[model samples]
Target: MTSHQPPLWRRAVAELLGTGLLVSIVVGSGIAAQQLSPNDVGLQLLQNSTATVLGLTVLILMLGPVSGAHLNPVISLVDWALGRRSGTGLTLPDLGTYVVAQTVGAIGGSVLANAMFEVGTSISVKDRATTGHLLGEVVATAGLVLLIFALAATKRGVLAAPAVGAYIGAAYWFTSSTSFANPAVTVGRIFSDTFAGIAPVSVPAFVVAQLLGAAVGLGLLLILFPSAARNTGDIVLPHSAEKTSA
Candidate 1:
């Protein structure tokens, strides 16, 4: 850990707060979209995607310095996996804490969004179960991972905030499942029945697909950037004080 880096507890808090705000943005915008564009599915999607893109960019930029803003469990895990051999990135215990914080934060965010919309906490009933949807999730998650790590690998980490947001916005339109790429977000969406919600029954398959996609993404990262050219410090925050040789 870098001398300037916050202690583990503070970093964990940042992760929790960041992930919570991210999910709140997703669920809140989805609810607002449904209300503003009642009958137009396309318009609703556009609204949701726009909000998500802008919100995500801001969130990453704001929180990256604190916790690397790994709002997604998969990103944290992937960072650990790639950097473990070099003892540069997240430790094994950090991985567990980050994932737990992200998951809990996401669930809290969903509930908070629902409360804001005057919708009491409720389980999602929207059943999104199909091979095509599952495949889309896999593709979406894979692309997301590829984009983030690719930026890190190529030393373009500064562009991650905007690039990641833009890719997710595009994936929302292109993917059949609307790109629920983060496992924590997927679990969070189960708490709402609005446009962004996913039924409990469908959560398992989506998670499995996301994990598989992450594996594929890791493989691609290894293939495309096999050397230890990446700076581990740039994995999460572009201008962070930490510098880990790779």
Candidate 2:
């Protein structure tokens, strides 16, 4: 790691904790919205999306200093991929560590949300795999990747917290799948049988769509900003591990 980067263990812990809390915010707020809004699906979505927007922004601000607050597998993978030749982002082993941490954290967050809501950890029966929903996932993930890298490339990474949160909040309404753009969060939602859950059978397609979206986003990012590769290390937000360690 570089001077600005924390050790792998610390970064991993940050990723795990940050991702866990993000899912908790998502799943917990969704459950609350369902109970609070009862029959009004629109109201429930509004409540859920609002809470997610604010909570996600807060999490990114808080954890970005530690691990770039990636909190998403696709972001980490893209960071690694983009910086491979430049050697400015995560290495292959670091990517593996990040993915494992994020996935485990996602599952744990779902379980935590279930417990908090007095619901058991049950597999979601909400089948979300349709042609339209799959297309939504593609769009949602693509937009997310494009936005993050664009900010980095443009030296606007400092605005990532609010910008990303706003984009996701907007996507919640525009997309059919509610923009479960993060693979880790997508898997986490599988453990909840509530409003934000997804059926296990839908996971593969969703993941595939997300990966394809990442590719599209990457292509767009490279074309739009030829210097994106050099700025890959600043994803999500910029922070110094050495500064924090001291």
Candidate of highest lDDT: 2
Q: Write the per-residue lDDT of candidate 2 for residues 19-56, one digit (tens) a residue.
A: 99999999999999999999999999999999999999
Global lDDT scores for all candidate models: 0.87, 0.93
lDDT by residue (146-212, candidate 1, tens digit) is 8888888778788889998999999999999999999999999999998999999999999999999
lDDT at residue 130 of model 1 (Cα atoms): 88
What stretches of model 1 exceed 4 Å from their correct place?
Answer: 228-230, 239-246
Residue 89, candidate 1: Cα error in Å is 1.0
TM-score of each: 0.94, 0.97
lDDT (Cα) of model 1: 0.87
For candidate 2, the C-alpha RMSD (Å) to the true structure equals 1.8
Which residue pairs overlap in candidate 2's backbone?
none
